[model samples]
Target: MKKFLFLLVMSFSLMLILAGCSGSSEDSQAGGDEANSEGSTEIEFWTMQLKPTFTDYIEGVIADFEEENPNITVKWVDVPWGDMEKKILSAVSSETAPDVANLNPQFASQLAELDALVNMDEAVPAEEKEQFFEGIWKSNSFDGKTFGVPWYLSSQVSMYNNNILEEAGLTGEDVPTKYADVLDFSKKIKEETGQYAFFPSIDGSHLLETMVTMGVELTNEDMTKATFNTAEGKESFQFFVDMYENELIPREVLTEGHGKAVDMYQAGQLAVLSSGPQFLNTVNENAPDIYEATEIAPIITGKTGLMNVAAMNLVVPKQSDKQDAAVKFSLFITNAENQVEFDKIVPILPSIETALEDPYFNELPESPSPEEEARIISAEQLKNSEVLIPPMKNYSDLQKAMTDALQAAMLGEMSIDEALADAEQKWNKALQ
Candidate 1:
């Protein structure tokens, strides 16, 4: 039954990929012919929301790339974040897709499952592949094949309020390193400092990511059935329920989001905020006083002892006739030198080993600012971090199911077991 559902889902998605390509395919082929006749291959490259801000940087990269690969010309396009999926889908359906595109795992998995993406393992050289971080590289893979090259990445870091912690008779050294410890610290913070230790945002994908970090297997081996109602899932999820019931954590956590958490942290209501280092800028800009009192620490861990990581990857569509040029351009853009240069323009860390070793990540000033400290701490955590959500075609749906179940359990409308069991059933039905 599961196998049949998997096939049905794949069929639907493949149809989505090939939906309107007939005429566009012919036009694309003719364009390729014209380019070939002119002794060059023109491959369109699209990036998500990296426009005007990084225009100079991207243009420079393109200029250097075109200079090096005289036979290839990259046609660059920047799509807004809100429109990227629709744009990519339309391009894929019409066979007018860019040869290379920037995408996260959730959407990239959609293309990967349809066999619409080039296998990076076959396209990228083994030695070159070794240069990327293992965890990030794995995110771009499905089954046994890699479909994308990992680019920049970010890992959550602990941004704790030093003043609040000190009021609770704790120091940075005493900050929580595990979820259980977070509970203990929350209880203590409430008792002593009258501030919540952390606001665990359930509105985003954090809850599921937390479960995965705790070694919860969200699905069966083949990802055809839901399997998150087991001992591990129950134990991990129960912690939140118990915390919410006791009012140890903020009640708003049940309905609020990262923005609320950030506002609370800046208002001195949260003892710690586990988020990407980028939030430090918000604190520094919005609440300089709180920013002054903030200190950095590694993200809280679980049974796996690793933090959650996310990356933007570059992929080549299977329909492109310029696979070699596309892969070459992908590599050139993500190579250590280029990545390091790009990092100078942004706050993200590089996926390449050599790029990570650059002085920007390693050499700290005698007295680093909060931003510098956050980046360094975050960069260090990348080695022990991974994208918690594994590639699944229905990943967004599964997350919705799990989130709804957890919310119900927390609201006292259903027993934890009942909630989880219902969620698992719904997830299975969705799979079908």
Candidate 2:
């Protein structure tokens, strides 16, 4: 009987051990399943200078995105406008780059050339590409492969100081419509007001865009050779040389960029400021008197009757493990509805055609504000504007060569022909 009791106790102990093992196995499996469901994939997104001002909106976007895509999360970082290039390059080298980033086409092209970006043509469907403006879409491509998705855009607008124009005996009706008319207007405004009429920044990309619009073909059909050394090119360039020599434009144009141009305009030293519509607010904030004197017009054009288009785009790093998630969120942010929402926050125009169709973009205010007029005219111009500077692998080199030639000519270091010829030579070499 004692032996029987001992066997019973031993069997009970064995049963307890077996129960504990079974419970441990079940708990381990359940824990793993929970982790799999809850471990959301995280992606890093970076934007240039869209912070503080756009914090709430972007945070809301991230939150909404997370709710809809419970398996994905976005971590947002805002970099200053000036540091974007260096920061991104460093991150890419260290293998710690953001999964996606905001960039201009020029910078994005450089990365695309280095094979650091994903080719959107292969990753994005054609229908999705159709969502953005055609010119914007084409601008974001590098060597036939798109590397970025276009986001917001701005078409240049003519901002005139009404007081200055009136002092120069010019009415709003006298606004320049063509490149030649711009020269004529500049001469009159300078003669009457003794203030510079226009200061087209030689350091900016505007000159190249204007030259293209004026029919100075920069390259051959395949873009393998430089072709901008012809009579049309020389004539196109001579216009600026004459403006500089005659003092119709600012003397500092060779060194001054867009910022200086805006400062000059706000200080009542300029009769006309050719810039994006958003600059109206700068004038309004910094020089309210001048803002009251400011009037908007469709940007002056050349032979093609089209203005240059500028756009900011979103790009995905090729090395990202979250490429799919990044692309998906990028599409979400740039979709028509979201882009329109963004436009309301800033004075920018959306690159999406359907976004431009929003009533906010379409309905001009009864008593139109400068912004209202600027947006309408700017949007209308986009229908005709081609991407003036299509993707060129040697874009930076070409820009430098052109600017160098312009400076040399303006400073009288070289004649118009000599300057353009030198630029042509440099361009041909770069293309090769």
Per-candidate Cα lDDT values, in order, are: 0.84, 0.81
Which candidate has the highest lDDT of all?
1
What TM-score do all the candidates reach, one by one?
Answer: 0.91, 0.89
Which ten-residue region of model 2 has the weakest summed lDDT?
27-36
Candidate 2 on 150-177: residue-level lDDT in tens? 9888788888888998998899899887
Model 1 lDDT tens row, 42-81: 8899999998999999999999999998988989999998
Instruction: List ranges where model 2 is wrong by over 4 Å.
Output: 1-39
Colliding pairs, model 2? none
Clashing pairs in 1: none
At residue 229, candidate 1 shows an lDDT of: 86
